[model samples]
Structures are given as C-alpha cells and as structure tokens.
Target: MIAVRHIGPPRLTAGLEGAGRLDWDAHRRLHPEPAPLTCEGLVALAEEGRLHGRGGAAFPFARKVRAVAGSAARRRGRAVVVVNGTEGEPGSAKDKVLLRRAPHLVLDGAALAATALGAGEIVLGVADEGSAASLESAVAERGLAARARVVRLPERFITGEGGALVRGINGRRPIPPGRKVRAATRGVGGRPTLLSNAETYAQLAVLAGLGPRRYAGVGTPAEPGTVLLTVTGSARFPAVVETPAGAPLGHLLDLCGARAGEGVLVGGYHGAWITGEAAVRAGVSRAGLAAAGGTLGAGIVMPLGRGTCPLGECARVARYLAAESAGQCGPCRLGLPDIAGALAALAEGRDTGAAADTVRRAVRMAAGRGACSHPDGTGRFVLSALEVFAADVARHAAEGGCGRPVRGVLPAETAARLRLEVDWSRCDGHGLCADILRGLVRMDEYNYPVIPDEPIPARLEGDARRAVAACPGLALRLVPRS
Candidate 1:
C-alpha cells in the first residue's frame, strides 16, 4: 500500500499524514482554499516562485501558461486544462499518493487553472483505479463533473507522455505519434491546452494558497517550494515523500529507512546512478541532482545495497524497458532489445568484455532516435549502469560472475504476463513475426526473430496471435503466463 511521508516542513502533503483520503470538508478545514487570481496574477506568482513542473522534465510552469494563453488568444478559442495524472514511471508513486490522499488539493489546482484560463474543460488522465476513484469522488464533491473529466488512461510507460496522453484522451491509440506535435497549440478538440502533471497543478494551488512569500518560506530562493518524491527499492517501506527543494538527499534517504547499497539511483529508471558520497552531498532539487551527475527525473530514489549483483539488476530493468516500449519508433522497436540483449550478455559474462562495448555502441545508436525519449532514457539507464559498475565489468570479465546474486533491487512491472516464444528448431529464420508484430518482435543480425521477454501488452494480444498464425515455419507462438 502507498503511504505519505515528509522530510521537512510539509507544504503539498500538509494535513495528509495517513493513507486515508482527505475528504473535501476535512481538506478545506486543514488548509485555506486558494484565493481567486487572474491569469496575469497566476503567471506572476509562478515566475516569482520559479515554479516548475514536478514531473520529469522540470519545465517552467509560467512559460507553459503563456504559451497556452497566447495560442488560445490567437485562435479565439478557449484553453483546455489537462491534469496529467498518468504516472507511468515504475518505482514512482508520488502522483498516486497525492491523488489518493489529497485529491481535493489536486482538484483545487486544476480548478484554479481552469478558472484562470477560462478553460473549456478540465481533463484528468489517471492510470490507476484508485486515483480515478479518488478524483471522481472529489470532482463530484466539488460539483465539477460537468467541467472536469477523469479518464482512466492505459497504464503504460509512454502513455503518460504529453502527445500520447492527449491521443488517449482523444480516443486514439495511447502512444506517441511518429512525429512531434505540441500539446499547447493543439490539444483536446484542437484547442490550446494547458497540460501538466498533477503535482504541478497541486503546486500551483499551494502557491496560490500561501502566496509567493509564504511559498518561498519552505525551500531555497532558486527553488522556492517543497518537492514530492517517491522513495522505493532499498527503503524499509515504499513511500511518497514531501521534501524541501534543497533538502539533503541523505536525510531523505535516512528518513525513508534506506540502506544505500551499491550506491543510490537518484532518479527513476531513466535517471543515472550516484555513489553514496554523491547521494549524501546531493540536494533534492534538479540543480542539486544534476550537480551529482543525474537528473531529478520523476523523483524516484532507488538503491542497491550490498549482496546484490548490480549488473544483473540493471540487465533485469533493461529487459523490462525493452518490453514496455510503445513500439511506435525504430529506436524503441529495435534498439531497446539490442541494448537489453547486450546488457544481459555482459551481466552473464557470455561474450567477455566485448559485450560491454556492444552495450555502449547500442546505447549511442539508440540515443535521440525515437519518436519519444524512451530509447534515449533506456540508453541513459544502461550507460549509467556500465559507468557506475565498471569494477563489476572487470570482475565478470575475469571471474565470469559478480559472485553476489541479483536481489531484484530495481523495479520492473510484470503484473500481467504475455510471452511470445520462437521455436528455433522448426524455424528457418523466416522473420515473419518481425513483420507481423512490429512492436513486440524484431529481426536480429542473422535474420532470426527476437521478441521482448516481458509479457505482451493486452492491446497487442491479437497481433501476437496473428503473428503465430502467419508464421510459415510455425516458429512463433504466444502463451499466457500461468
């Protein structure tokens, strides 16, 4: 179960100390409802606070507002406010924790944006049932059903991306388009849309409630506000934590009962690994994390303690990322699996030190080649692993192993299982499966079909079966995980 924890004075998570959802009345009692503000006022406050999206990108909130407002004004159309709650990054649960425990705050923030922009609608894209239910109940409480839509989007890695989430909201495939399309200019119903993650909206509400000066009371002048983070992996218990922006990373880890084994991964899967010394020196802000050689991407702090094989753990996550690709682009479609394959080879010491070089080459090839950044992110993950665990590379080279077992310290979601298997004995490298299931299957160097080892997405089950049927050699088959 998800729970809320805080490191310093809490701003976003105030009055939310337990797992129970704070009802509207209870929430109102605990924190004052935000005073009404005009668009200019909102933008001015955001600039003052230097407010940025709490989501992975840390994008400037003020710039987004201006962009949306300008686009809407140009078209003489109303803006659409989309609260992105589709938290797709595994090992992160801050959005879920907020939606479940403090739904009203999130709604209040969305409502604030809608009012400021004179938005046509407020669309909330949620992934989990609990978040949807909490939001729906909160919307009903505020009598906002007419103005707000709480949609349950596909719970996949890429589904939370701006274009993908917008597509899902528009009743299209919930994956990134083959090309770039900015959501600010064209979004729901082709109107200017002010889209940002749920925590961003909540932060806006906090800014409004406290005003600029009081909001600046919590964090540094540069990053003036608390940030929420999801602490997982080596922590004693998984938690969504509220921490001051410049708070020491070490304190946060200690508060969460973390044992920094094999160093700490400062961000999510896309984030790089930091040594324990860096972790102690690192601040929780984006600047702080960057200084420590990682982005504060998605605020996921994971660690691998002693006794675990770090390379093996990285290989496990690499495989998961390969399987979770939206399959919309070539880098994700083909390159991810290659990286995963190389990482596995290196981890298993299958091909000696050359596999490590292959992993590096694959990462470079995959970078900046996807419709989305999934490939780039995956590359970052594996490349960071190779850098942080160089000693493990030499050990495996000489000893053929790390001696320690993989403890599964990194998270790779596998709730549902769908496997695509190739029968090598009957197969003649027909490679039909590659053509049939473009997303799940790809052709290797020798024309043999390679499939992601993770479960097949439910949406692709039919395509998987078709590939099975179309295989001339009967080399491909799909089997459900029992």
Candidate 2:
C-alpha cells in the first residue's frame, strides 16, 4: 500500500545526520564559515530566498527583521532577539530534535539574527528543563555566555505563543494581552525584539552560509529551502524528517511508511484533517497543503489509520483543548467547553438530536472572539474534524456509538489547572474575584466565590492570578494542580 524511495537532501536537518549534540567544534567544522554579519545583507538574502518563519505563521523572516531593525534604529537603542524553541504543539517534535541534537546550529542562527538587528542580547526560551540545560551548555561551550541566556518556560500550550512568551519572560503572566502589541516595537522590557521559532533560525543558519541562490536550489520556486516534519501516529516509525519544501507529500509519507488512504492530520491540533491518498499527493509546502485546504502548521504530518475511531479521537482532543484555554477572553472560556461538550456527546452517542447544530453554533460563537488567534484556530480545527469525519458522525448518530475504540491518535499535554483557593478565615465576601474571572469564579448564594468543576485552563490562568491579586480580603490564592 506504500511505495518507499529516497526523500532527498536535508538542509535544516543536515546537523542531525550523525548523532548527539553537534558540539562547537563539529558545528564550526560543518559550517566552516560565518554569514555576512550585516543586517542589510541578511535581509537581502532572506528576501531573495523567500525565507518564511517555520513556526507555522510563515511570515517573511526578512520583513520581520526589517521591522524590528527599523524600530530599533529610530529609537536608537539596542534591540533583542528571542529564539522560540518552545515546541508546544503536542504532535510536533522538530524543535526538540534540534534543541537536543543541534543547539549550536540554532544558536548560530540566533547570533546571525541578533547581529543583523543590532541586538546586544539573545534570549532562547524552552519549555522543558532538559532543553534549558542543553542550550545553556551549548552557550557556554560556544563562549556566548555573556551574550545569550536560556530561559525555562511553563509547559502550557499558549505559553509558546510569541506575545505570551514575551510577556512571560518579562515577569508578567504568560498570556496574551487584551490589545495587540508588536514585539518588534515593544517587547523584552520595552525594547524592540526580533522573535522567531527554533527551526526558522536553524534554516537561517543554513541559508546564511549558502547565500540565496544555493539555498533556493532545493524547494519550490515560491518557497525555497528544506522543512522539518514530525511524522507520528500510523507511520511505521514516528520520526522527524527533513525534505525540500516542495517535495511531494506522498513521498515523505511513504518514507515514513504511511500507507495510501490512511487519514492524515496536518498542521497539528490547530491544523486540518485530510484523507489519505489525497494528503500523500499534497505538497509538503505551504502552498501545497493550502491547495488541499490545509496549512503546513509547524510541519506536523500525523497519519490517522482506519483502525482508530475518528470521532473518539476528535472528542478527546476537543476536551483537551477545552481545558487548555488561556481563559483571558469570553469566547475561548465559554464556547470551547460547549463545543467540547457537544463533541463528547456526539462521540458517546448521547446527542439529543441537535449535537451537530450545537457544535456548529458553538464554533461560530467561539471564532474571531479572542484576544489572540486561539478561538479562531480552535474553531477551524473543530470544523475540519467535522468535515473530514462526516460519515463517522452519521454512523455514531445512528448506532449510538462507533464500534471502533478511541485510540487517542492525536497527542495532548496534560493541562495544569490554576486553582482559586478561597480562605474563609480571611474572606469578607467582597466578590471581586467573581467579577474579575467571571467565567471561572461565580458568586455563590451567600456572596462567596464558587469555582468551576474543571481546572482553570491556561488561557484563564492569568485571569485567576489577577483575581487572586485583586482579592481585597487576601483570602483567595492561586495554586497549580499537582
């Protein structure tokens, strides 16, 4: 059912060719040369090569650097560079692979960007402690201890968001602010910050060394260069593979041992679901997946075999997302849970004949309503699941359940809830918490605060912190789930 062949040259993953972390010596040996250390030169190369951020946004990296550099130039202050290695998407592992195996390569890219932007400091953010240790060691080994610092970030999905990351590093709650603030203009203690994900920087390291023409040789004419794909689920060997941007999706899947006709979840949780053979034929590039009504989100290409219950998978992920909300906005707080509940009812065959409509309505209510793209992205994911699994829905609706068991093919991190603990001893029943986190904290009949059955999701974790801080009685405190 699958045809295997050579996948092609690997640029971003070239450092991963051998094993272990590419030490400073091996790194300098492989690279052998540094990029043009000027901002204009780097921007020109980026523009010519059409290099985009590999962190799912696909924004032109050159343009982003120019924006931050321009801002810094006008302000006459040193800018900051942030390397986002917090690969929070559960189905994605490319970032971690780079962090563990090729820290120096990633840092080289960061150094390039920092030099281009005239930034004095470079900050690398990682979710896990192991990555922090690895990066720290790499910085010391490369004699970058004075210029680069490694930061440990909370392992929450939303914390990986660019703005939230900036806020977190600044000692604020790691959540998106109500208003949009460009990091290029205002970030990292009010200085211009050039921020991008890890793989993006790794690609830049390769591009800067090769220059535009040679770097553009491998991928499509529109989007040139190699991409890192984390293949999981039904693949024979779940792995992180590197292929030229325009490589046929089918070949990449085949290389990973995915059979034809197996469903694929492209772009991770916020991405869409596409059927097997069609997905395989789709290009691995942004334009390729766009034609298939999908996006190459974080280059996560997961195969969903026929053996798993598609509805069950949807339900589990939906619930996990429902609990992962940052709770900063109303739609993300209220609508996600309702949508998750509807999906759960549908999966369990307990829908009251209106589950489909309820899901559609909740999705509509949730989209375009949050401070960040969380609501809209979550809605898109749910909508795609509904569209791709239409037949499965009908089967469940009629049979009271799909016979196949729930195989949680999709991955999710266990969410840590921020709990609002009410101390009656210090309580004056002022009810300010009920006002601040209205969605999570409710006013009891006696004016005390009543919390929800579920833990405080990430989106609302900041709000819970706010509620605790604002509590006049000092009775309320925020605690994490053990």
Candidate 3:
C-alpha cells in the first residue's frame, strides 16, 4: 500500500487550482524559526542534511550557497535572493502549488537564504498571474513588504530559466542569450544573486524549522529530506507527492493507483522515457535516474498506459516541442520542423526515409546552435523517442503506418500549436517552400514541403515570405501564433 503525507498548508490539492489564496499565519507555521543567515552557517547546515536543489538539476544546495557567499563576500557586493516560481515546463505544477497554497513557506525560505548570504533584497518572480498574486499577498500579510517583492513575468518557457528570470527582472525580455551565464555569479540588478526554484526555497524553509539532523532523518544517505513530485497519467492518486528523495517509484505508483507493468516517462516532455517502474523503484534520486540514463527533469512522472501507442505519443510531443522553440538559432529554427514532419509522416502510414534523414540532419545541425536549451531539449526529446520506440519505427518503416491514431495524451494546446497545416488539395508539389526556406523547410521524396512545427524566426522572415510567395499553389502560409 502507498502512503501520503500532507505537508505545509491543509488545502493543497493534486489538481491545478486558479490562484488560491493563502493564509500567512498558517503558512508560516511550516517554518518554526528563521534560518541561519551566513554562508558558512548555511553551507554547514545544508551539508549536514545533504539537501539538494528541488529543481530538475539536483545540484547540492551547499555548493550554490558557497558560490554566492564567496563571491559576494569577496567583492563586498550585496547578494540578492530570487525565488524562481516561473514553472515553465508544460506539464509541471509543483512550484505553482507551493506558491499558491503555501506562499509564506517559500518566502520564509527566500528570506532565510537572503539572511544567510547577507543579501540585501529578495525577489519572487512568478510567470502565472495567480501564483504572482498569491505570493504578493502573502508577502504583504507577513509584513515582509520591505524585504521581499514579487515580480510578474511574461509566460514563456525559457523565461522561467534562472538567467532568463534575472534578465526579465532587469527590465529585459525573458529570453536567454547564446552564451551561458550563471544567476548566482551575476543576477538581479547585477548583484551576486542566489536564484532557485520555488520548491527549493520551500525546502530551505523546512530545513530552517527542522535542524539538519532532523531534516536528514527521513531520506537516503546520499540525499536526505522530502521531495515534491507532480505525478500524472495512468496513476489513480496523482497529485503533488511529498516523499523522501530516494523513495521507490513502484511504491509511488501503487499509492497513485498506477499499474506496475507499464512504461514510465520520468521528468516532463523534455525528460527521458524509462521502460519499467522497477528502475525507478531501485532508486529515484537524480543520481539514480542519471545512472539509468534519465534525469528527473521537473519531477513529472507520466506513465504510458497499457494500450497507448508510445510512438504516436512521442510524435505528438515532438511536434509540440518543435513549436515551443524560441526561433533564434539556425538548427532549431530549421531542424525541429523537419523532425516533427518526419515523425508525423511516419505516424501516418507514409514512407519516412527522406523525412527521417531530414530529422537526423536537423538534430545534428541543431545540437549546439541555439541561445537556450530549446533546441537541445527538442532534439533530446526526439532522439530519445526514436531510440525508445525502435520497434515502432521498424513497423512504420515496413508498413508505412503504425495503425494507431495520434492520441492527445501530451498537453493539447502545446501540441496543437506545434502542428503545421498544409492544404494538400492546393499543393502542386513544386517544393518552392522547401527551396526558399532551406534548413527550415525541405522537400521530401514525394516533393512535398516538410516544414518544421515551430515558429518562424524574425531573422528568417525574408526567406519564409519568399517561400510563401513562390508556392505556385498558394498552399503555404505561416500559422498564427497562439
């Protein structure tokens, strides 16, 4: 039998609720005392408990704290604390749940982290209006009006990144630059900033209330303390599950009423697909998942149901990811659509050799050509799909069809936005769109234009327009942005 423990607020639920209000007094109870406000103290505390960031990348919290503390102390510059509540991953709701239901817990964590690092300010950046409002109201109720402020951000996936959030708070658009930058090194008005996801802050709050030893009491030796996972798909008890870091996946599925035999997709769409829950049961920590060739990206567990077509689902998600690209890089701008097209053709009982070749070439071209992880992540999603669903690929190759409909198991809106619609009746197969768009659009063996399912970059507007103009059948046009 599975176990469920409700932490923090009493009203927290498994489903997405719109901007639920929080009670600061009740929420503050989650943290009994303020955290130690020094780098040495915080690091020692974190190291003692072996706490890691709750975000997808489970880097040690002590290391991150040390980095900011050492730098800020050396430069005599203020260290800023940012609570990252953007939660941009399509299928994630854990951060949003924390912010909406227990905002004060997150604030306590941020405030404690700020005090520890000797930071002068705290900024909570949220992408959703509901989450932002809940946080803002909580801050006001806690009388932390002077110490912490909430900033509402535009809703874009990349904007939720640590660097992107820093840039957005600095009055810039929330898009990542081509080069890599760490928020802790220079973030939030150019200060030595300690930025982490909302759940990370909440964990800090928990640590503050419970001493390191006590916090370490519940989890594994390698990683201690509870983790929050947003579980869904083929699971009966799907919700924001709070369990020890190395909890068994089979136990979680049993608690959630999920079948034990089906394949599981750990992490979100950008995450890898695992064939069995036993792999998860053996270990569920970041390191454990990594050893299994999967990273717990965003802590989303989606089980492929017994009758679901894995390839069909993958194709659906690939198309969605292709559309989510920021449209700034050469390969992503051109390569993702080719990948999506190939998958779509393969799914629809068509010969996909040319399309598959395009996908391979595009994946290579897009590997490191983007400003953000958008291209890399999209490529990873597709490549993983191809590998995991090799049997399906073979079937498609032999029969030109998978004999399965593209079920909308992935997020629908995102999938719809990623699909490119072409009027076949008007197509003359002149392949002008492919000729003019080059890397972004290509002609398959059938001489039809295979366009990527992503947004066209402003940089490629000239070529895209030319392609549309050259279409003899007037069958090509850009899809309206959602």
Full-model lDDT for every candidate? 0.84, 0.81, 0.71
Clashing pairs in 2: 250-280, 325-459, 326-458, 326-459, 326-460, 327-459, 327-460
lDDT of 3 by residue, 1-482 (tens): 12233333322222223334448655544346574666678888778877777777777888999889887878899899988899887667788888877787788778888887878999989888889888878877878889888898877666786767898999887877667888778788878888788888888777767788877777677777777777776666666677677777777776677764436777887688776644446466786777766677788877766566666777777766665565666666667766776677666656656646556666787787778777777777777667666777778777786676655555534422222347889988887777776555667678777666555544466666677777788887767655
**lDDT tens digits by residue: candidate 2, 119-219:** 89999989987688889989999889899998888887777888999998898888878889999999998999999999888888898888889988888
Supply the global lDDT for candidate 3: 0.71
Which of candidates 2 and 3 reaches a greater lDDT?
2
Clashes of 3: 8
Q: How well does candidate 2 match the true structure in TM-score terms?
A: 0.86
**Winner of 1 and 2 under lDDT:** 1
Which sections of candidate 3 miss by over 4 Å? 1-22, 260-262, 277-280, 353-361, 415-426, 436-441, 450-473, 477-482
Q: Can you write out model 1's per-residue Cα lDDT over 1-482, one digit (the tens) per residue?
A: 67788877787898888657889899999778887778888899889989898888889999999999999899999999998999998898899888888899988888888888889899999999999999999999989888998989888888888899999999998988888888889998888999899899999989988888988997888998898998988788778889888899888888888876557887788889887778888898999999988889888998777778999889988878877778667788678877887888788777775889998998888899899888988888888887778888889888889898988877887555678887789889887787876535666668777676667755567778888998999888878765
TM-score of 3: 0.87
Angstrom error of the Cα, residue 211, model 3: value is 0.9
Using TM-score as the measure, which candidate wins? 1
- Residue 37 in model 1: shift from native, Å? 1.4
